[model samples]
Target: MKNIKIVSLTACLAWMLSLMLFSSCSNDDANAENSGGGPVIESVMPSGYNVDGSMKPLTPVTLVDPKNYYVIHGKGLLTTQKVYFNDFDTYFRPTFVTDTDIIILVDENTPFADASNQLKVVTANGTAIFDLTVAPPVPTFSGFNLINAVEGDEVTIKGKYFLDPVVTLAKTATEPEVPITIVSSSLEQIVVKIPANANHRNLAVTNISGTAVSKEAIGTALYDDKLYGMQWGGPWSGKGVNFDFDGDSYQGEKSWQWVFGGWDGGNWGFDVDMTPYKAMRIAVKGTKNGQVNFSVNGGSNYVIPVTTTWVYIEIPLSALGNPASVTMLTFQESNNDGGNTVLFDDIGFVLK
Candidate 1:
């Protein structure tokens, strides 16, 4: 009876030890899973579908397009904290994250996106780096400054994707293209000198990606000089008159409130000879039917009729005594009775 009792006790002790060891091992495994070791990026893929709407396989891609969705294959992605394209933060969804996959959307407004294509992923455990080639969208042509420009004058073209641009000018669609000298080039702007004999026909820019042609002829000119392309003036407040760019055209807004003395003005003075040009052409639009006065050399006032729509007002230099040297050009609005607004653009000279 004594030997039987000892054997039973030993068996019970052994069983308890086995249970304790098993429990310990199970706890360790749970902790390991909760920690989610360091993140590892395997590959990046683009998401798209076929015509039938069937899901496409997550094939690896080297290039990424802005404003598009992509999938990242990796481990420990569930704990991802952030994703960056270049230095720009992008959007990602935690719900889309799995132990081995993550979904992200590249930001459309990523700065210098094509210039720097390094993608970085961060997690609590570790970070991963990937090299991506970014393909930017095709270029766009909005408009340019100095619509009527003379030879040797710098004309700035504004738009998008101006990388390694090639600028050309022609008198008409049928004329041969003439290359203009580029003074500077950037992603959104290019400054070039108007070549001699440029016919003011069509101005176009071609980059490696695409091309943009102006909708209208830049305006006729053989010898032209731009005084104010809406890039001047001082700080003042009244009924509120200001100069700004409206994407498609330069604008001048003027209010004839009593607080503003019922007038707003801007002036430019240069030593350019106005004898060669026939008239000063200005593109303007007003709130209602009114008249605005323009003065050159602080001399006679040239009254221009304003309509609700835009119209070109040509003031003959001959009307201002055909000044031998242009000292100043002034624009003033004082005819506002109850207050009025106006927009002006393409302030320059027209060749005879």
Candidate 2:
């Protein structure tokens, strides 16, 4: 019985030793899995000041700037596959990635939408998602093409971040506030019409990001009596000829389309005295490099060179013998089967 008791004590001690060994091995395996298995994001920091690889305090910003580099802190991030800021996929270099951190740059063309602001990091093991904020830059108003625009004129506002912009003309103490009609808009440009009673003190543009007011007041006019603006003359005749008041243009905020098919022609006729103007300027954009003939008052034809991009073709009024009373201005394309398309805008006289 004494021998049996000593054997039982030895067995109990062995079992306890075995249990401790098994627990230690299991803890080591769990640590390895946590370090090597899935990705984990702890914090994000700007790449400029993250020189020592230490996790900085997370930014409290609600929107992350585009085109800026940021560092992410985590574990199991060495084999990162992709990274996304909001809905935009950004670039991440494996060389810049490590087991506990990642470097990435947010794309510039990311669209602003009402989607999740979660930053996602994908890896072979799993994905790590963190709630983030990303937004576009605020709208900026640099200047406009036409500083002095009339009521019926389409003014082109040139700036950045013009997505879904709202343009308004400031009201005077006497005059009521007027909202300018936006004819068309793009990411960098916006075309708006000057209201009839607009006392253009300040031009304001608001977008999803923010609002920007012009630095200087735009000169508003009721009518430009000196300039005879012929925008998209629809009275002309030509095959495949089309005109749109809200098309792509390099001048006057809009363009007219003229499709040429074997000697197509168009003209605008008016009974007026154009002796005051020294030259006639026509902004033209063509499909290819070519030449078009223009005639004034049915007199000598002046050849104007056109190219694939928008160009101003200024013809001296003396080329047409400086007619005192002008009756017609005509344009004719060369005969060809290529069916070239041309865009024209701002056909008027300038004082040189």
Candidate 3:
């Protein structure tokens, strides 16, 4: 497959300027170009530069990037009134329309899921449709399972835009990247086998659109199924803490559940050097919607909004008073809805 081109803003402007020049031709020619009864799409190609810094030709395309320009080569397009990709009514300039071509940019807001995968061109007389695919955006690295995984263990990554992803352990100063074996994959998830010679490294995933590197590297979990470095379960006033809640596992084999009442909280004791980490990340959902006061070292409280469905959140260390060490962690029922259960998983710090 050919490399996906990167369209520069300057080149895009140059093309638009050329379109203005095309529109400056005689009115007789414009009248003759717009005389056709129906538009007929011959092909579509990218309007961007090749990977080698050369201009891309008018070769037919199978996939078009969002927010990128492309040339629609067709007949009777001088009277082109509207353009749509995957049923999205994308805008196009009349000056960009000609007898056999319409240069347009794919809208960034076009819906990419569960819709018609075809480009439609409507002219004054009739309409035309062609099979096409709008490429997904870059991968979003949420979190991964088995946070303390070692070589040859299986790890599941949770995120979106994993289309045809290439998974690899990011390269370190001492060694090159180690490619992980894919056990299975989907648009939102990937299960992989940690390869031999693997270290505690971040995973990098790349699809056709772009690449994404995980925030939390392998083996950096404060809690996956259970809390790490747990000297104690809770502060004196906390209640109903479950170490292994099997009802749902957002990241690993289980999830941490807290049943708390008004003014109650769960506290755990640990001694972790927070210098190497940047942010605290977790996937949380509640029996019902609410908020919790999340903190470390009993410092400042960061209000975390919870929902019925799990929402992954990353709180920067600076927001939590930037403690140098973590001796105690706490989560208080701040938005008390009488009493409720909150589920937590993928609980860990983002390695620097």
lDDT against true structure, model 2: 0.65
Collision pairs in model 3: none
TM-score per model over all chains? 0.49, 0.46, 0.65
Q: Which order, best to worst by lDDT?
A: 3, 2, 1
Best by TM-score: 3
Residue-wise lDDT of candidate 3 within 235-311, one digit each (tens)? 44645888799989776679988887876886778888888788888889998888988888889889999889999
Model 3 ranges with Cα > 4 A deviation: 1-17, 20-63, 74-96, 105-134, 171-176, 197-199, 234-239, 246-254, 271-275, 282-327, 334-340
Ten residues in a row with the worst lDDT in model 2?
1-10
lDDT of 1 by residue, 1-352 (tens): 0001112334334433543453355444543564557776777876443335444455788776666666776556668889888867878767656656666666767654356667788998888888876555567876676666678888888888776788998445357888989999888889899888764466788864456886434544211232233333432342353444342233222212111234665565566666556776666667676767778878888887777787866678888768876666666666767435666665656555
Winner of 1 and 3 under lDDT: 3
Q: Could you tell me the lDDT of residue 265 within candidate 3?
A: 81
Candidate 2 per-residue lDDT, tens place, 1-352, comes to 0001112334334433543454355444543677667888767654332335443343534456676556676667767998988767888667666666665666767666565878889999899998877666788886565656657878778888776788988555666657899999887889898877543456788876678876445542111222243433433453565554455765445566777765677776666556546766677778887877788878888877778988866668888778886677778876355556777765655542
lDDT of the candidates, in the order given: 0.63, 0.65, 0.81
